[model samples]
Target: MGGGADDADCGDAENKLGCILSYNSHVELCVVNYTMLAVSLVAAGGLLEAERRLDPSRFGRKFVWQAAAFMAVAAFQITLCFVVNCSGVSIIWNAVVAFNSITVPGDTPRHFLFMYLLAFAMALSLDVYYAFTLELLTTIAHLCSLLLGGLGGFMYLRAFPNYGRQLRRPLLGAWNGDGGGGADDDEDDGSTNSSTGSV
Candidate 1:
């Protein structure tokens, strides 16, 4: 097994190291994309259910509309990911297909759809961010990463204004088993009533 041809076939260890790194990166990126898709779908479904159960006095028409919009955007991203995966083209060509698929739209503005695309694109760049050094390009690229992530986060929070409250209330209730948040809610209600009465 040890000969000139075997030595050439095995090649240098450094070359093998690069291949190993590239293979691991692609595997990790696929894992991240699948995770993003799963979480997006869960968030979209939860928001839709919350909208359905919302009280008009607490959540007005505007609130409902925003919830719907957020849900739609999440669903749209999930759909695009599936489309790209099913197309079986290389990443570059799949991106072209995704662009055409999203832009030929109906009601929603093209620019807003681009924001959804930007969020996914930023997610995909996570691997590149890890691989690159801290230079000007990397700095600018990471800034774009944060901006897109923030935009998507803000939209989700806007759609679910009481999300934190609701999420924490359950944990609080479970921990104390007496609904610990009720007193704080009562105080808030009392303050609101008094302020409204004065008005």
Candidate 2:
């Protein structure tokens, strides 16, 4: 009797597993995943919109620029996975880090962004390992946001020259000229020309 009961329990477990595998059940998990994914995507979109309205000069400040790139990386990965069923999130994340290392040196915001990406990627790996539907989907979405945000930030930075420095150059030249009596020469020449014409 005990053996028969054990066999029945095993059979029930197998049936439940089959139902989950078929995707006809576990509606709650699916709903949660879908909801989180939608929210993540929408949030990224909002950031992109706000980024467009901001002045390009702001990106040169370091933190804001790198943060934008980070967001872009997250967005790209998530969108790729969601739309194209990508499974290479790790590869893309590493590539971003590598790009940063190669292109930007010193203790910069990109390093900080690297740390952040590393942490998020680890969390995503754990979610996948445990077969967590909502958690996995959320991680993917977050990744996409980071990816896309970084790209948007980079684009914004590229849209303008170093406006702050460019603006300063002319001002600095004018100040130097004034200090050297360059303005006085112009006035003196003008006065001499007027006197000659009058005579």
Candidate 3:
């Protein structure tokens, strides 16, 4: 009977340890994700600014500037990730500690959700800007890029399936390829040609 009690105590201790370890791991991942998201946001902003300053007629030059901005952002994000790794702290812990401690008054989850939605909104806005400036081929490429990022975000949000549902609708339109305006315009021209048969 004494041995049974000892075994039960040991089991409880083991479970507690496992829980602590899991929580720590979760925290570290949160930190890394948050950092990456933050860096990406900065990069998106730079790209937007560059896009805004670009001459509309200078498509080639504009693409070059945009690409340069993207490279710069990618470099910064990579460097930040490397620095976090070198600091001997788990990136997950960075996320866990920051988010838990940084809550607004009244409702933590709601505030965090709003923050995420705002990030999504910014990304979507960038996508719209890209769509407007890029040629059809480039626009499709950029859309694909956004889609992949959205997929990754969705997977992350999936861990909190209930909360993830709230984010589902706003992100849906982000993946939609450029509107069919170009196609419609082309169709109109083709029909006109067929009707006239000379021009």
- Number of the predicted model whose lDDT against the real structure is largest: 2
**Per-residue C-alpha lDDT of model 3 across residues 1-199, encoded as one tens digit per residue:** 0011112122233344332223223544335334545644443443333323322344354445434534543444234324322111122212222222221111113323345445545445544554575345434534444443444334433433333212222322322422212334445756887899944
Please give the lDDT score for candidate 2. 0.38
After superposition, candidate 2 runs with Cα above 4 Å error: 1-60, 106-199
lDDT of 1 by residue, 117-160 (tens): 45446444543554353234333433443444445545555655
Q: If the candidates were sorted by their lDDT against the true structure, best first, what order would they fall in? A: 2, 1, 3
Q: TM-scores, in order shown?
A: 0.32, 0.26, 0.27
Number of the predicted model whose TM-score against the real structure is largest: 1
> Which sequence of candidate numbers ranks them by TM-score, best first?
1, 3, 2
For model 3 the local lDDT of residue 92 reads 24
Q: What would the per-residue lDDT of candidate 2 be over residues 88-164, giving only the tens digit for each residue?
A: 23323433433332222111123233443344454345345434433354455444544544554355446544322
Q: Better model by TM-score, 1 or 2?
A: 1
Q: Quote model 3's TM-score.
A: 0.27
1 against 3, candidate with superior TM-score: 1
User: What's the C-alpha lDDT at position 84 in model 2?
Assistant: 35
